[model samples]
Target: MIKIILLLFFSLNLIGCKKSEPVKSAEKDDKYGDYYVESSIGDATYLNPILASDSASGDINNLIFNGLVKYDKNIKIIGDLAESWSVSEDGKIIIFNLKKNVKWHDGKSFTAEDVEFTYKKLVDPKVKTPYSSDFEIVKKFEIINPYKIRIVYKEPFSPGLISWGMGIIPKHIFEKGDFNTHPANRKPIGTGYYKFVEWKTDEKIVLEANSDYFEGRPYLSKYIYRIIPDQSVQFLELRNETIDSMNLTPDQYNAYKSYFKNYSKFKYPTFGFTYLGYNLLNQLFNEKEIRQAIAYSINKKEIVDGILLGYGLPATGPYPPTSWAYNPEVKDYEYNIEKAKNIFKKYGWSDYNKDGWLDKDGKKFEFTIITNQGNKSRSVACELIQEHLKKVGIKVNIRILEWSTFIHQYVDKKNFDAVILGWNLSRDPDQYALWHSSQKKEGQYNFVNYENKEVDKLLEDGRRIFDEKKRQKIYQRIHKILADEQPYTFLYVPDALPVIHKKFTGPEVAPAGVGWNFREWYVPYEQRKYEMSK
Candidate 1:
């Protein structure tokens, strides 16, 4: 049987060789085929635009789905399915007009009813979407006609238009079932440039161009998203030409920039944060002085320059540098060991020899700093912090857990002393879910247990302040207050490194995420020829 199989394979190879001669003899090249993109994360969840968490997935979802209003690279609202909109003077109502020509990838007309259905379905408490909170302030959504809709607000909402960021779902698919676990979620239909083709589990998700798309058919006939679990393996795939593009860490970016000099790279500041959070529920950490000491004790510059290898900026607060509301005037807790010691001493944790740690009333000051496992860099950062804090007679145990446990259990319960985590800030300023006092219950993400009337008021005021300048001022004050309270060790704002093959071009890294202009981006045909020639 083996001999027969080998003989058949050789015969087929011989036939293929004979067939290739005529093509080479003609000296003709085939036209570009498709754009193939690869990344570390798999399609663990389906490509439902409403549910995607990361930027790459979100970008692709946006290509497959159209929001009411899309943003430009500068985050300026541009029309997508919504041709235009009008905001009421009182800021409580917004009316939008749907584009009549748009059609879903499934060939359904994109209508205002879909927009209304999306908001109504998500915000309904029965659905239990984490993103439902994004629309909490919305009171009602009314479809006035097939091409028009009106949004009524519970109160003033500054970033009301940002609601458009949630890709409108087709009412036909998700009319029933909690969308979080819906079967339609696994196979979403949207009115963008691409159509869902097939998902090869644990391997790749394929998409074909939607020729009937309103903006004209995409240049690429197909898009293949190869799923590679490990970052190292993903990079290796890029090197081996098995995959074309992937997001890289700073270290990986630097390594590949040198090794694959011909390849292209798109680096941009992420609208996300990486911070060392204080578990304020812990008795030892409840003290404001101790918290401030811990914040000051962290060498942020070292973490940014040494650990992150100068790929990120020192975080001022929870938000990134490019946020419109980011306040430069806010105070940052600088690295000051003496000051940290002074604060620790004032907090009565000065005794150095009480069971290999600092002590207050015979109690040893020791707690674990938890972070997600499988991240070597974060683990190293935690270890370095553990050593640094030890110098101040404080003992920090590092407890690394899987990503889900870290986020849902440790962070939600506020069970750890400190945590290293990241947050992808939403387009709107309603951070109540993460920062409000009401979210301190277990399974919620208010890790700090931080509660301040003044700060709460500032956040509340900022959310309603439509004026961008006013909002900035409010956030500046809020940031300064948070700095003083020391609820978290504001660490570094890391940039995303998307390593792409030289053959494919135009993965622009904007502030929000990579591929902000994904709709119009095209990989030049010349590179396609080069790839085929090779």
Candidate 2:
């Protein structure tokens, strides 16, 4: 979840030196020099940012693509590609003014046309992107000129401005057929600080700094992302200095705080929560009593303490505790075995034959929790949940699969009884993508298939009512409803434990997480590791 950026201004002077002689300092030689090496547990599925929703793709996309806007270190909305923008009095119209001299990786000028085209692809049903819902609210989309564009919404969309932060793809290259299988997905061309150089699938993705970047030439010459599937293996690489930065596992973070003098660890609340999600379509979980009983049976605090090692808090709802929409007053289901057993008994589930396992109509109460491989915390949490549920006459199993196959074959196909997973909460608090009943279709975020008329209405109203106070009320109701329903046994929100090598500079953790102002991170000449070709 952490990355570094380099945007150092370089001014080279050769008045007193020969071109053949090597200069040690950037001012004497050149600004760009060293390279940054980071590791990921999975390979990026696609370099095209718009087509990607996973974290691995996002890490690489952040270096390769530029959004119209971005978040500052203070968590404030700031301009990136766009220099400035304004909103109409009604709060439905937005006009953007883009920065000049910005170009794509291929040296094509960036303009409002690219912005318009990006929106076009977002709304194109044939393209199939998860971001289509936000753009669907647009009533009018127009490119006023090369450096300007205007958008009018059908209604007051609260997250409209921030939503534009999504990466803007080039119109010149993507204005072709079948965006799903486009060449740009693998070998991309972008306008960010870094340019794509080379990618060996399941191995590494490399990027070189853009000298003609709108900001400035980056100090680092290269950015390398090494793919190491297992966290244990990644930690080994970190110990060996094979990777410069990594988000450490809770156990690893606690165990390796003083492991080395050349590295430093950082801890902060992440915008995510891990949970045990039930397939509502499964007959075993159809009744609210069964779901509530399962929620009551599991000890969130115990899992957070034992698995997270006192590094996380029990999740009360979908939104993180720091989010404005997070309702603290929402009822918390503390662990109570007696209450859980009574609820199951009320729903015709009990150990009638004293076999110590619940059964109804000769069907034993058994299910599986499928989680992707490579995450030790989730696997351990599953083990603990299984033991807790066993005390209540329920048999549980755990299944692990690779990342890509896990999503494409099992998750998207709805071929699961339950799954252990996590969700990164959106900063804007508009969660229509996850909670809306309509989002249960194939390849959508709401794979849980949870449907409630009231929840849907609140989600719709949460986006329409942009006012902070009014929207707060709408989200509050949604939190209460989900907490009561127990659609997922909302487990815990773990702290992100990111560790980086000490040689890198200009990194300061902020409300938006560690990498918000990544472009500003730099490495001093003496501390720079890699040498550039003179």
Candidate 3:
């Protein structure tokens, strides 16, 4: 998952500092008036929601598209484009009652066919969507009427009801095109509150209010996502008041807390975790014992304290501490250098010449860890780990790549021996794409090639289970299994520090974090910066 971005084209061209006098809502009293700007580090790879797996694309898609169901402010599974829904007692069937009179941004009527088309595309083997696992269990898709449909699953799938929350695509536009070259992917037209305006590649993306939005028009006249690559530059833009909000780095948050007193600063646990993933396909990491030894050698608490500066928690396993499925009883590989060395010795890893490096089969134990540039926490964590592991005769090289290049050349192709990366977490705990061995196809989410018959079985069982208590037990077992296996040394769950201009109001903290009620946030007329409120 990725956030939105920023650009230099409009620097010092938009708004004023928050210190400016508060004024009345004379410019955009009736909505369609004010514009809010935000920043993103990486540019969007695809605007097509289903085809896009990165966070930047997902964030933009959330605005231009509407899922059938979404998490409410309190994190409850609630209806969005779907007015209501019902589940069969057996939990194998779900029928959705889509909202009536809903129209796509192109003025086309939204119907059950759109949802059906979206689901079919997801499950199509020809289509390379990472989300196909959720739909593959479907026994069949039944359209009862123009505004109603029933989805019958082969088994009692736990995520089935919430899985329909995938954004619906327009079949009329998507069905006939070369999927990647489709105009809809770049300039999308959806039934959500925001209409796509323009995307200037790496510079900026703009969206305007949709008057025919099912819920009603948004309070802001326009929403702009700017592409500012450097976090420091983004903070400067935040200070200069060129952007309304941006996710702040821990250092930036610490420094600007008092400086941006007039701004609305929010601190909450992001659902995701940063990790060091190993390429199991590589010969160096093919040994599970080597991976387990490395896990015991490093100090995760040191990274949490020294790198994150107390803005996060040491990640124990795949699930974040906040998740109901997170198992606190998983076996932890605490920092122990001697124990790591003992494990290494038992596995035929040793430094016979005392050259301060471990070697086996005449090959030195050395590998590189690549991570995307612009993430300070990740870079720092790698640097610290390099130092920590070097003491144990392990050679680690660090390489930072540009965002787009990193994903396209290294991650998607599984070219690196190791990588320090982050996963944009799913609200639902079905981590099939990130962990399932079958999903290791080219361009798929599970690029690491992690495979265990037990993990696969647990994931399958957990998804098919409808009982919350039962699912929790299965996930807990999976967590313990993964913890013992140590595919990725589960790192840290950083606290998201997003600071927004105080002029924007109506934001409240909740289980879903902020931004769920963004459509309701409005700036008073006197505080409005642009006459474009027209």
Candidate 4:
């Protein structure tokens, strides 16, 4: 599903310490020697951008690769590998002028052929990727020359330009091997600021700065990604200066606001929402009334207050309030136990045997809700939901598995009754990849098996339209329909609480969040801690 599992942290915590003053030095004075160490809850599943869907992989991919276009700090589409591009008058054809000087990490010259190869691989039937939908609408991909390429869409696909932001893979290295099981999937070669050094499974992944990078060498010499599944353990590492950054849990954000002396904490509303998704294929969840009942029974406010420590807003639909597509008029299912029980009773559920739990067709109203391990907020939210559902004569079981196992074995297989997960959204509002009926196949994002013909049409129409006002209406309608359908009990939009060591400079919070200017971030030679190494 291209699910973003990257831990995002936001609210600024500056209660005890004063903000560090900006360095009174020129650009030439910037030093590049220290390392920026960060932690993730899970290890990356694949370094290959096309095959990788999880956010753990995304974190590393962002450093190791570049797309034709990328989002700037203001959330606007800007050039990355491509220097510029122009769309046809009809908006179907786009010609990109690729950067001529870019070099792949393996020292190969990057050209239009690489971008063309990446597009072909994305639509290739043998490749197992969740991102195929984005490129499937393309009618043609043509390489005009060594540094120029053209893309013709089947129609005026609204997300056509931005979809190229998918990481461009190197054709030279991948052409000889099976793209799915390519050796580079584990150890990738790319044109980004960082070059892959080593990946020790379930432990750490390391990369060194590319001196010949087209945009100029990254000021930070090394980028170290450590896998510490437990948030508490990550916090301990952050406190000891072993790791430079991590997303702080709400409790950690609230209670330890003034604890860190050498760290800068940041918090902002994330563009994602957590949800309780049901397996629609399950007989128990196939009924819309049952899903609605479950939604009504959940106390979303309680989750926001208790687990999030009032750091988040209850979600009513797929888009957060920050999104242009968010439907403000679509009301959420109120937390009402009596309404939920009445709906259950109307749907043939009853305590026929005089037991505390409700039953239908001699089967008890019981189901398990699973989420990834180490995310204490989700586990605690599950406990609260278990209590809420129990009060409504439903028995809810909670299971926490390691991240990779949970996604591959359970989520991808649809071998789960229900799951608590979040979607890291793109700035674009076209949700065809996540909600379309055709996307339910294995390795696709529609893991819940949600299918609605009306939604299918709406998603298609939404992508074909280009006008802002028209597209806004289309997505708003989709939001309302999904809100009423209750395929997922849309949960909350939690504030991102990222904390970073204060030694490095150049991070700035913008509309696109921090880390957009990561290449420019540097530590002064006097403050450098780690030595440069391959």
Predicted structure 3: lDDT: 0.79
TM-scores for every candidate against the unseen true structure: 0.84, 0.93, 0.93, 0.95
Report residue 12 deviation for candidate 2 (angstroms): 32
Error of 2 at 69 (Å): 1.2
Candidate 4 lowest-lDDT run of ten: 10-19
State model 1's lDDT. 0.66
Better by lDDT, candidate 3 or 1: 3
lDDT of 4 by residue, 63-154 (tens): 88888888777777878888999998777999999999999988999999999899989999999988888888899889889999989998
Q: Judged by lDDT, which candidate is best? A: 4
Q: Which window of 10 residues has the lowest lDDT sum in candidate 3?
A: 8-17
- Per-residue alpha-carbon lDDT of model 2 for 38-144, expressed as tens digits? 87767777798677766777778877887887766566777888889998877799999999889999989998888998898988878756777888999999888
Better of 1 and 2 by lDDT: 2
Q: Which candidate, 3 or 4, has the higher TM-score? A: 4
Error of 1 at 467 (Å): 2.0
Off by over 4 Å in 1: 1-32, 41-60, 198-203, 350-354, 360-363, 373-376, 408-416, 426-430, 438-447, 509-514, 524-534
What value does the lDDT take at residue 349 in candidate 3?
A: 84
Off by over 4 Å in 4: 1-30, 532-534
- Full ranking by lDDT: 4, 3, 2, 1
What overall lDDT goes with each candidate model?
Answer: 0.66, 0.79, 0.79, 0.84
The global Cα lDDT (0 to 1) of model 4 is 0.84
